[model samples]
Target: MVKRSRRFVAFFLAALALVLALAFVAADRWSRITARDNAELAAQSVARANQGLLVSELQKFRLLPLVLAEFPDVAEVLADANPEATAHLNAQLELLAGRTDAAVIYLIGRDGVTRAASNWRLRTSFVGQNYGFRPYFRGAMRDGASELFALGTVSGRPGLYLARRIDQNGRALGTIVVKVEFDRLEKAWGVDGGIGLVTDPHGVVLVTSRPAWRFKTTEPLSRRALEDAVRTLQFGPSPPARAPLSLSGSEASVGAGRRQEPYVAGTLPAPIDDGRLTALVPLQPFLEDARRVALLWGLAILLVAGAIVAVLLRQWDRQRMLLQSRAALSLEVERQTAELRDTNARLLVESQEREEATNKYVAAREDLARANRLGTLGQITAGVAHEINQPVAAIRTFAENSTKLITRSRPEDAQLNLGRIIALTERIASITSELRSFTRRKTPVPVQATLGSIVDGALLLLGAKASSQIEIAVSRADREHVLVGDRVRLEQVLINLLRNALDAVGKRPGAIQLTASAQGDRMTIRIVDRGPGIDPAIRERLFTPFETAKSGGLGLGLAIARDIAREFDGDLWLDPMEGPGAAFIVSLRIAR
Candidate 1:
């Protein structure tokens, strides 16, 4: 039963675990999908916002170059006809460049020669330098306006060159150039965990949030593009690194860093421009977010599952307990019902037994009364003969002795002898009277009697048959030991025991010892015989009717004796010991 219960519990737990695991898995997948979408949106927003800043910054200075192209110091520097106007124009350009945050303001002739510049006074000035091969100069001569990023030939610093053609008389005279550097913009864009970088049409990073990434190409450069970059020296001679990210899909890109950290990128195109602005944000936040969501939701789902399982298990257990309790109650009721039936059967059996015992008692009483009368008459007859023989022999001896004294002329002696004869007759009469009374079947009448007196009377009756052949002696304390019982019945029991003792000692050297003692409410009378002990084989039924050891015995002696002893509310049993001879012990209630 216990094993089955445990198996049930184990199965329940396994089922609960399976349910909880499924719940956790489902919740984790859902959370992961939601988190991924959120990450994509977040990355795209960063990319677009950074892109707006880049475009706005570029627009802020876009008009400056176009406006500067219309300025005319009479075009005197380009013609070389007014040195005063050129110097004054140089000073004014310097002041304008400072105010507008441009790197340099310069003018070039139609031959692409640096005619006047804001840094004309400096050692590395663009003044008097020829930039006819530069793309911005070449493009400005052909087109009305041009914009290009290149390295300055005189200063060797990288900047975006915006140029416009100065046209007069249906021909281009010189170009007005404006150099834009975004040192402050780079600092603002690259700080505070947000980044933005512009990639050229050829996929090179022109400016970036991180300085280390500037001038890096987004894709592998071919031999031609490398050669072009080397020849121009626009970004120095260093081999540019590939951009950290590659386009992944519509809105996201896969990015790798120096240590190969995972990143997600969002790309945007510059409006009315030729570059791409991209924002690279680390994917760690998205991953962490997804992981946290998975973990928390998984735990919550499992907790709810466990709680529900607990409630179900508890409810199941309660039902099981109720069922078991009903079974136990049923068993208890059955057991009690069985006991009640058994008790009723026992009472019926006892009633039948009681009725049978009553019938047996009535029949036994009538038989006992008749048996006692017959037994009294028989023992009385034997006792009378035994008593009459002893006194008759003594009378004869005294008669002969008196006759001898009379013959010797002793008259006084003769008178004394006659008196003894009369006394002997009186004694004989007393013996006869006692026998008559003893032989009558009277109701058992208890009187105070000594143990010794009872034993002596029984011995005298047995005296007719070689009474001196076996010895009999009583202890002094037992001779006067008092008790209450019918003297005749006790005497009868004693006489039977002594007869058996004498017959056992026939023709052998033996002795009889009688003992008396008291225990609790009873007095014990033990008759011990030192003759051939009672036969062992018949000892078990020694007191049963007609069971005896003697050759002609009726075996009624012990049976009758034991019954008479118990008639006084006492019992008898043979001594259960290693006896030298037979020993019978009887107990009688002691008188108060």
Candidate 2:
């Protein structure tokens, strides 16, 4: 018996050892793969952020050349080469360059000779520089616009050149150029741990976080390409050297000998065509941290499992010894009874928890419905206040005037003023009544509501809060169009749509058109505005709750309006148009 017990112990120990060895290998492999993936994700995020900065910078500078190209001074300098016009433009360009944080803004004649520059006052001014050989100048002359990233011949600094052609009477005048440098951007990238690089189509590094990596070739260049690049001086006097980095899929190895380091690389295409932005993150740290954590967890689990097994084995031995005793049978009965009690207790607790969860869910749903109505009312609160304010002010004015007239024994005029006050008070009451009816969360009672009355009610709520510059024209035939819908709810839908149209055309020279047309048994009310159209970014989610373009909007008005329309078996939608501005169409059942 002793020999058998010893053999069993040895077998269990060997099994535990083998299991631990297998777990270690599996954990290590999994952790390494997970670590690399995490590194790649991080690298990708960095790459996108850096690329956004590059694109933003490029876009900002590109606008400068276009603006300058339209300047009369630029055309004057290009057409007549007037020294006074050139000097005046030079000062103007210098001031503009400073305000816009651009490196330089210059005008190139049709011959590709620089006539005026923002840096004309500087020692290395490009005022007399002949850039006829530069691709930006030639391309602008040929295609009317161009952009290139290259080393500036005079300053030897690298920047992007955006050029736009200046034309007068269909004659090519010259090209206006804006140079934007990324020194500050590069420095900001370098402050972070990872390396950032921007490469052109030919894999030539145009900008890099590491200055040494700039003007370097990410890949080998052909003999003809090298000669062309050198002759054009695109990268400056010295030929671009090969960077000490190699890429293989998502992995990268940088440096040489003992200093070599591995990285997880991620890349994104730049906004400019054929350009790419890359980020390289060190892989060693991630790998080490992940593996160490995984190993520790594995060891902790192995220790816990071993302790459990030992406890079980000791219990077995104790039971074996106890089985020889007289009280062993009683003890086993007690253990089974205790287990049964515990199971019954757990079942009772679970049943109670389920009941509580169901009750909470029902309450949450009720709260959400109430909140939705309140949110809709909140969006129109400002407009309602504006609608009531004018009448309140007029009532106050008429009340004061009546008191003065009564004291002067002018009873007739006093009575007239009092009547005016009464009329104003009635108007205020009407506004409040309309608002209160709109907010009531009751089922709609469909009734025949004239289209003209609905349009007038919505306009009353809008008031004169917006500028009088906007013309709201309603077609005369709308009065003949009647709809089968809840009058108050339909008015609310019109109010929402009209309010949006007014806001869209605010301070702009545009008119709001309220047109109604009949198709079979349905009537479609169209609210069209000549304002800037709906933004494409939010077009897909226009009717979604909490999706809004207005800064101070709650984004619930349209959603609530749409819901109200659908309650009467009608629908509201944005109509497509070939012209500028937006059109909202509300279709309802026409009165039979």
Candidate 3:
């Protein structure tokens, strides 16, 4: 049972393992897909937020230069090249710069000279300094307003220059420029986490959260882009994006400062300044989450599979126990059968001795009683002797046939006849053994047997004694049905029921019906006699051992038969009814 159950479990586990593995594989694939998409979204969200904040910051100072250009004093310094007018404008410019949070505020003349400056109070002042090389300066002379990001020549601070043309009646006079710095904005992005960068049209990192990452290019710059950098001096004295790192796809490991870290990066176009925003997210946390889910699912599958296998093994053990019990029953039945044969042999010898010791005839009154009591016993004994006679007679005829074949000098024909004679002797022995076993005290041990076979064996043992009165008929379906009981014991039970039925009819031409049937898991054999039914007085103690209605009966036959039936997981009873004769029914378990 264990071995067979293990094989079943192994196959079960193998099938379950395959299904679970497929499920895990599907989950893993889904997790990877979801993680990748979520990473991109996370990076995009971070980029959009930082970019919006940076643009709003820069926009706050956009109108400053244009508004300052229309101021009267800012034009006074340029209209008259007077030192007193410049000094007055410089004082106003300094106050305005502090109010507007400008890094440096200055007015540049049409000659590309800084006529007035806010930082004139410091030693690195822009008064009387030439700014013709600056794009904002040249652009403002023709265009009304222009913003350019670059490093200041004097302050050396990197900032955006918002320059506006100073005009009177459509005639350009000088330009007003406001320089804006983003030290605060960059500092804020750093604290919020994730690397932030705003690149120019040339792809140069202009504003960044990291100091080391500033002015670095995400992709390679061409010679023209390099020239634009030189003219604008957007990176000041710093190198243009540190030889543009060799970029892979959105996800890759690259050096940030000194050490390389794995990252999943994404780009979003900035709506404010036409720059690109990029963010990188790590993959370690996502991987850990998928691993945890897989572990949990795997554990659950094992638990369920283990439970099913345990139940299957338990059922297997029960079946194994039933098989072992059946084997033991067969052995026990054989042992009892052998013992019955021995006991019957001893009893027969003792009976013969007692008969001889007693007188051949009792006195007149005792003779009538003895004849009445011993009649049934005499009939039963005659039946057994009659059963043995047929086989003995066949043996005698075959022996005569053998002798005649030998007289004809036909050795082969003689040998064939001799074999039949031997077979007949064995049949006689078998009949006697069966008769002895039938009369013995039965100790039933249940085993699987066909009801029909037991019924046929019982009728055969009765010989011609009950053949004329008894009509035995079993349904074809019932004949094939199995009963769980010792074969010999069941045969004995049927024989007892039949004999009682035959005796009930006696010499009368009455019908005794024997029929086999099945209901659910039970097999039944019914014997009905059409003779005077059992008397009410006798019926009360019908199955009591050693109490009999028949004068010669010890009454142990019906009691022993009932007991044997019960031992074989069956029952024998006289079913009550308003009928002509008694109906005895035997019921037993069907083999599974």
Query: Of models 1 and 2, which has the larger TM-score?
Result: 2
Model 3 segments more than 4 A misplaced: 15-28, 243-253, 256-259, 271-273, 293-592
Show where candidate 2 strays beyond 4 Å: 312-592
TM-score of each: 0.50, 0.54, 0.49
> lDDT by residue for model 3 over 255-330, one digit each (tens)?
6566665556667776434666666565555556766776687788778878987877677887888799999989
Model 1 TM-score?
Answer: 0.50
Task: Tell me the lDDT of model 2 at 383.
Answer: 67
For candidate 2, write residues 462-509 as lDDT tens digits.
Answer: 555542433545466656677787777788787678778877887564
lDDT of 3 at 211: 71
Error of 3 at 302 (Å): 4.7
Q: Which sequence of candidate numbers ranks them by lDDT, best first?
A: 2, 3, 1
